[model samples]
Target: MKKSGMSLLEIVISISIAVVIFIPAMNMFSTTGQAVFKTRNFSFANSAARRISQRLMAMPYEDIVEVPLPGIALFDAPAESFFAPFLNTSGTNSGAKNITQADMPEFYSYLVQHDFRYSLSVSNVSFGDGDEIKSVGILITWSENNKNMMYRLYVYVPSL
Candidate 1:
């Protein structure tokens, strides 16, 4: 009598070959997923930075100046005021001067909940012809997979 089905040894060899091919394919899929996640996070950070920059540019020239607030570092005052509109209240003096997670708008709180932090700074810089302009910088930082990532954006607001 002749057996028509595959032998036990043949079945074992086929399974081993399938595993060898399957391992690499599964690894590739996992790597692709990680890359996509990182890219999405990066895109969100970049958009946040740009939005902050645009807000800075739209402010009046005088409002963008770094004012020295007592017991606080320079530029802190203007930075806080710059973000004041996005706070829960309409007035700058409605609450604490410092920006905390609680002071963030709904959209910003959403970003914060996702582990993102941001900072805004404006400094005076001299361009060609000795004209002084306000250079606004926005920095966005986030953590991903135990790694820290940052994105920075700069915009110059000329005197009006």
Candidate 2:
């Protein structure tokens, strides 16, 4: 009998080869997707940190809240928030006054959706005279794929 189409064995072999090639391709695509997600999150954290830093720089030296070392934990907690005015607090407010979902709905929403949180801390930097400058630090933390990540922005603000 003359063969008109692929034999069963031939077909099976071809399918097996295709599967072997496609499986790795699919896995590569999945890995690429995860990398993109990670990059996106990093970018967002960077942008937000810069923005918050800018805000801190623009404010009067006295206006910025000053907390001792480890004043605000790097984690999310309303009571110990770094951005006081922007923090959303419950009735009879209590916390560090950091950024929150209530005070900053849009920014907070992005943080909430991305599982990001931020905290701020300020320490006296005695240069020449009394409280001539302060060291400000903003900490942004988030969880990605069950891993914890953080970004810290620190700068010195001279009294203006």
CA-lDDT, candidates in order? 0.65, 0.70
Per-residue lDDT over 1-51 for candidate 2, one digit per residue giving the tens place of the 0 to 100 score:
886988899999999999999999999999999999899888977876886
Clashes of 2: 7
- Candidate 1, residue 87: how far the Cα is off, in Å: 13
Model 1 C-alpha lDDT per residue in residues 50-134, reported as the tens digit of each score = 7667767776677764422111211122444444434454344565443444444554454545566666577887666856788
TM-score against native, each model: 0.61, 0.66
Model 1: how far residue 26 lies from native, Å: 1.2
Clashing pairs in model 2, backbone N/Cα/C closer than 3 A: 79-95, 79-96, 80-96, 81-98, 82-98, 83-98, 84-97
Please tell me which predicted candidate would have the highest TM-score against the true structure: 2
